[model samples]
Every structure is written in C-alpha cells, then in structure tokens.
Target: MNLALHSVSYAGVWPGQERLSLEEFIPRAAALGFKGVMLVAKRPHLSLLDYPSHQPEKRQALRALLAEHDLSVHSLAGYNDFTVGPERPDVPFWEHQIVYIAELAALAHDLDCPAIRIFTGYNRDGLSYDAGWTSVVTGLQEAARLVADFGVVLTVQNHHDIAVDYESMYQLLSEVDHPNCRAAFDAWSPAVQGLHGNELAAAVRRMAPFTAYTTVADYVALPRYRYEPALVNYVEEPARMLGVPLGEGLIDYGTFFDTLIETGYTGTVAYEMCSSLRDGGNLDSLDAYARQFQDYMSPYVAKANAGVAAATAR
Candidate 1:
C-alpha cells in the first residue's frame, strides 16, 4: 500500500489552513516521507484552466517537479455533482461535467496518474431519487468511457448522496459495468452512518473487490444544542463532525486497515485533512496531523508490502 498525502490537506479549503502551490506541496510531501501524492484537481493545484490539455509544456514542468522530489501522483481528485441543475433541465450540466472529467483525465495521463477520483450526485429537490440515480449511472458510464481513452480509470468515491453506503456503492459500480469505472471507497462515510466493529468490517469487505483507491481522515462528532428561550432550556441538535489526526478520533482505522490488508488491497491510501480540525488548520498542525497518519499507518503498510513480496516469492 502506497501512502499518499492528499494536496487538499494543504489546499486551504478548511478554515485557518494555509494554501500551498503544487510546486511547494510536492517537495514538502516528499520531505514528510510520502511515496506519492493525490492532487486536488482545482485551483492552487492542477486546475484545468491552469494546466490545460493542450498545454503540454505545463504538464511536463509539473511532471519534472514530481520527479525532482522522487514522488509519483497516484490520483487526481475532481469535484462534480451530476444532479446539480435538476430544476434547469435545459442547462446541460451533465454534459459540462463529462467534458470537465475528460479534460482532467487527459491531464492525469500527462501527470502519469492512473486514476481520477469523482463523486456521485447529491439529492436534488426538483429531481426524484430514481432520476438522480439514473443520472449518476449514465453520467459515470459516459465519463468512464471518455477517460478510458487516456488510460485513466474513473474512481467513483462514496462521498456524495446518491450511493454512499457500501451496498449502494457496490450496486452503483456494478450497474455502471464499465472496465474503466471503479471504487475509491472510504471508511469515513460508513463510520459516520453508525457502522462499527464487525458491521464496519463487513462494509469494507463488501466493497473491497471493487475498490481501487481510498482516502483516510479521522473525525469526531461534536454534539450541538439550540437555546429554546420559551422553554428556558437547550434543545439537542445534530452533531457537527470535526476532523482530527488519525487514531485520535472516532474512526476504527485499525479494523479498516486490517480488512483491506486481509482482502489483498494493495492500492494507494491517501491521507486528507479537508475539514475544520480539532487542533486548528495551521501549517504546523497540518504537518503534525500528516505525520501522525504516516506514523499510524506505517506498520499496516509494511505488513501489506511484505505480503505482496511473499506472494511474488512463491
């Protein structure tokens, strides 16, 4: 298992986090001992507007930078929601996203990245659930076909609303039925959905076969309360999830990693600090968290690698 530091950790999307350019991020990730990186495919990183497919020079420069740091780009993360404009049916939003992914796929090929991570659609007010499902299925099918030409696989992460659970994500991948389409499964969603212990292990096993990539971020749920002046009391509200360093939060990564290893998942596992974190999101905090992930996952990675070596020896 190749450990990758996702660029989003330093992309400054989270409050108080400082943004780092791809040039700055590459060497820093190498300094932190990561074997590779997972780049966020947007501004402050590898945006299409910045690294257009026609601009081979920019891609080459970026490739050279990665080589200088002895780092490989394992995957590129893309942002798209196929059910965004259900009310505006005439807008052709789906087509626009498909084209966007195609361009990203081209960029990934140039960067020597094998996969592009994408999400399914969120539930829309004007669209029925069935309609949203169909939109994602067809959209992924087309996107998968488009990226295949570039030798880039489209990894549908279980991040969005359409098919986030393991069962539904498995069904979604199976329904797409394209060789270029695969899973970028993560434990965060299932953990938040109250799956744990044996149940969580089951979920991982169910999606293991289809999973080609994954991202890790530990989080703790902070319970909230609302003031009710009339009743002179506080009303309990839904909890707010906050990110934390790996192994310091509620996620059962030990179980998660054990299952992945047992199932022969020797794919890229990326660490991301994409949300408001408990220790705040300054560069020091981010680096510490990143280092913590590296420390936490080292043994599991070593065991997985040893298993692969043993299999080859036979």
Candidate 2:
C-alpha cells in the first residue's frame, strides 16, 4: 500500500494564495514524503460552488504545478450533494438532492478524478432512522449507478454529521449494489458515535469487502465534545478531532493498520491530518511535525509495505 496526504492540512495557508499559490503546497507536501496530494475540488478549482473567475487558469496551473512537483492527484475532495431529511409525498427535497448529486457526478468525471468522497444523507429535522436511511441509500444507489459508465467511483465517506457508525456505513455501501460504487473508509469518524477500538474493527471488517479506498488521520480524544455547530460542528477547541499527529492522538492506529492488512485491502492510506496547531504552534510547523509523524508511523507502515512486497513477490 502507498502512503499519501490531503494537502488541505495546510488550509490555513490557502487564503494567502498570492503569498503561496497551489504550486507551493505540492513541494511542501512532497518534502514531507507524501506519495500524492488529494486536492479539494471547491470553487478555487472546478465545481458550482466557488469558482469565481480565473477558474480555468487556476485549473491549468494546478495541473502544471502537480507535474512540476512530481505529485499524483490521488483523489478529489469534492464534498458533494449527499445530505438527508425525511422523505415526503409532496416535498421536492429528495428529487432536488438527487439531481444535485447527478450533476456533481458528471463534474467529477470531467475533472478526471478516479474517486469522489460523499457523506451519508441524514437530517435531524423530523424522521425515523429507517426513513432517513432508505432515502440515503436510494439516492446514493441511483447516483452511483449513473456515474458508473464514466469510470468514476462514488465513495461514501464518514463525515461527522449523521454518519451513524460502522453498521450504518456498511449497510449503505451494500445497498448501493454497484461494483464500481464503493466505500472510502474514514475510520476515525465513528468516534463521534462513541464506539471503541473493537467496535471500529468490526465495522472496518464489514466495510472491507466493499472498500475501494481509505482515508486516515489521528483522532485526538477531547476533554469534552462541545456542540460548536458554526465551525466544523466541532463543539470546542482542543476537541477530540482527527488529523492530529500520528501516534499522539487517541486512535488505535496499530489496530486499524492491522485490520487493513487482515482485510487484504490494497490501497493508498492517505495522511489526512488537518489540525490547526497540532502541527505545532505555527503554520510553518508542518516541516518538523511531518518528520516526527513519519518517524513515528514508519515501523508499522514499513512492515505493511514489507507484507505487500512479500505477497507481490510470490
């Protein structure tokens, strides 16, 4: 398996694009030994959201920058139109959501992204679990099938909001029922539902058979999970968020990595650490923190690589 990173780790540095263009992020990531960079497909690039102007120029520059930096575009972090609420006979909610999803699927295909990350549709408004899940599964299945011919994979990711747990994620993938549509296991997100290492393991095992890719980040246990809905829905600062340092966080990475091995999962494990100060007291802290994280996880990653080599050798 290969190790990569989501360049969004440096989100703080993005607003200062003039000071540091997208090209700057590639070398920074490459220097950290990242095998690839998963760039966000938000307005700055393509998509209906925020591609104000110079969008075409920005897209070309991104491609050139990747070539110049010798980096591969592992995935597109599109964060598409996967949402949830109760279904209704009169409401156009479900139809609108599905149409939005199909449009995003075509956009993903046009950008040449092999995979696009989506969240499970769940709304807290008014509905039973069954109703919400059914709507989610139906929407995802139809949309995933729609994009299958384009060779694009619709991967349901474990985002914080409404992502129930291991069982739910497993079920959603199964319900999709298309070979090209698969799961992108974002393991740490389950902690939001208060599951432990063993429970997480079981979910991973269940999802593995259908998993096409995986995203990883260290989940730091917080003092208390506050309900901060405004920003990232994170309750408080110093919260138990993912994307901290490799081993310092609460996630049982040893178990997670072993589970990946046991499941025979052969895909890139991208380092998705997005912590603000966890990199260090400053933005420039990435260099030092990246080295330490690589050093800390090296033994396990090396062994994982060795196992792959031995198997490939045969």
Candidate 3:
C-alpha cells in the first residue's frame, strides 16, 4: 500500500511557511519518501476557492508545479457539509450544498483525483435522530449522483458527533447505497463509540468493497490533571487535541496495520496529526520534522512488507 501525507498536520500554518504552494511542501514530503500530499485545496494555499474552473492556464500551472517537485495530488480534503451540527436541515441551503459539491466534483475530475473526501454530518437541534440522519444521507446522495458520471468516488470520513459509531456509519453508507459511495475510515472512531475491536474490524471489511482510502493515527486519553497540557499553546486557547507521535499515541499502530493487511487494503495509508500544526513544532524546518515522522512509520511499513513477502512465499 502507498503512504501519503495529509496537510491537516499543518492545519494552522500560514501561507508563507508550509503549504501555501506545492513548492512549500512537495519537496519535503518527497524527501521523506511520502508518495503524495493530501492537498486540502483551500484558501491562501492553492486558493482553490478562487481557482478558475476548467481554465487552461491554471491547469498548466498546476501540472507544472507537481512535475517540478516529483509530486501529485492524492486527494483534496474537500471538507463540505461535514459538521452541520445538530441543526434541522434547510431545504434551500441543502440545494446550494449540492451545487457546491458539483463544482468540487468538476474540479476533482480536472485534477485527476479518483476520490473526494466527505464527512457524515451532525444531528439538527431538537430534530429527531431519524429525520436528521435521513437528511444527512440525502445530502450525500445528491453529491454522489453528481460525480457518478465521471467515475469519481466519494469517501466519507468517520468523524464523531454525526457518524458517532460504526453502526451509524453503516447506516449512512447504506443510505447513499451506490458502489461509488464509500468509507474513509479513521482508526479510532469505532473504538470511541464503544464497538468491540473485532466488530470494528469487521465493519472495515464490510467497507472494503467501497473503501477507497484509510486514515491512521493513535489517540491518547487525557492525563487526569486539572487542565490539559498544551499541544498548540501558542494558540492561547487550543482545542482538545488527543493524539500525537505514531507509536507514542494511544491507538495501536501495529495492530491497525495488521488489520489493513487482513483486509487487503492497497490504497494510500495517510498520516494525519493535528498536534504539530502549532507555532513551535519546528515543522517548517522540513527535513527534521518529516524525517521524524518517517522514522516512526518506516518500521510499521517494513513489517507489513515482510508479512506480504512471507505470504507470497507460500
């Protein structure tokens, strides 16, 4: 399986430092042996918000940038309709969201990205769980329909709140019930929602036919202190981010990789971390930070390859 870097690790870095352009990040990721970058296609970076659609000049510029650094776009984060937190669905806004997804679909097609990432959203306040779930599914289905003609797949991430559990995820995917609709499984969400590990693994296998991508990271429960340690202290008040350093984190990397092998997953295995996005992580030094990340991941990948070799020998 290929390994890729998701730009979310550098979530708060400004335009000048990390990933405002391919030049800022591609070479660094390449040197660390990452296969590609999960470009979010957002503002101040690619300014994807303003990129002229289907424009020849812009397409040529993008292609040239990728070629310059021996890199390619893995998938755009395209975080649309993700956390529509517990609000009753708006018919008009929902229709507008469809148009937004269609534009993103067109852009994905132009960039040659095979899949788009979406998030199963939240329950509307005071709305019954049944109605909220139905609306979320219908919204995603509309996005699915727009991209089906181009053979592009929509891979939804298992963020909690909306997709709070494995069973809930199954329900969402069932609603969108199309082959091109699929899962982008995050390692810890199933466990967060209290599913048995085996059951969670089984849920992944069920998504196998439709799982286009898989994101990996370990989570650590907070130390029982009065207040949390500062991961992004520079933010003055940071969000309660839990995971850090591949093996050091709570999620089991070794077991998770074993599961990936069992499922025969061959797509990109992406490294996603939000802890290092802060002011003092020294990540912009590039080689230092990315190499540290590579070091953490290298052994896991090697172990996986050895397992494959052993199986092939049989």
CA lDDT scores, all candidates in order = 0.93, 0.64, 0.66
Candidate 3 matches the true fold with a TM-score of 0.80
Candidate 1 regions exceeding 4 Å error are none
Q: Which lDDT tens digits does candidate 2 get at residues 133-248?
A: 77677877887777676677777777734445667677677776777677778667665565557876777788788777777766565475667657867554654453466777
Tens digits of lDDT, candidate 1, 57-157: 99999999999999999999999998888778789999999999999998998888999999999997879999999999999999999999999999999
Question: Which of the numbered candidates is closest to the native, going by highest TM-score?
Answer: 1
- Give TM per candidate: 0.98, 0.78, 0.80
For candidate 2, the 10 contiguous residues with the lowest summed lDDT are 13-22
Give candidate 3 misplaced runs (Cα > 4 Å).
13-22, 82-91, 194-200, 224-239, 276-280, 284-289, 299-314
Clash counts per candidate, in order, are: 0, 5, 4
Give a tens-digit lDDT track for model 3, residues 1-314: 66778776555453323432545666666766776777665654444556667475786677677777777676777666633544444546666666766776777777677777777666556767676677678888888988887778888888746765666787778877987778887767665555445766676666666677877665556533343357533323322445455666555556556677777766777776645432234454433445556787676677667777887899
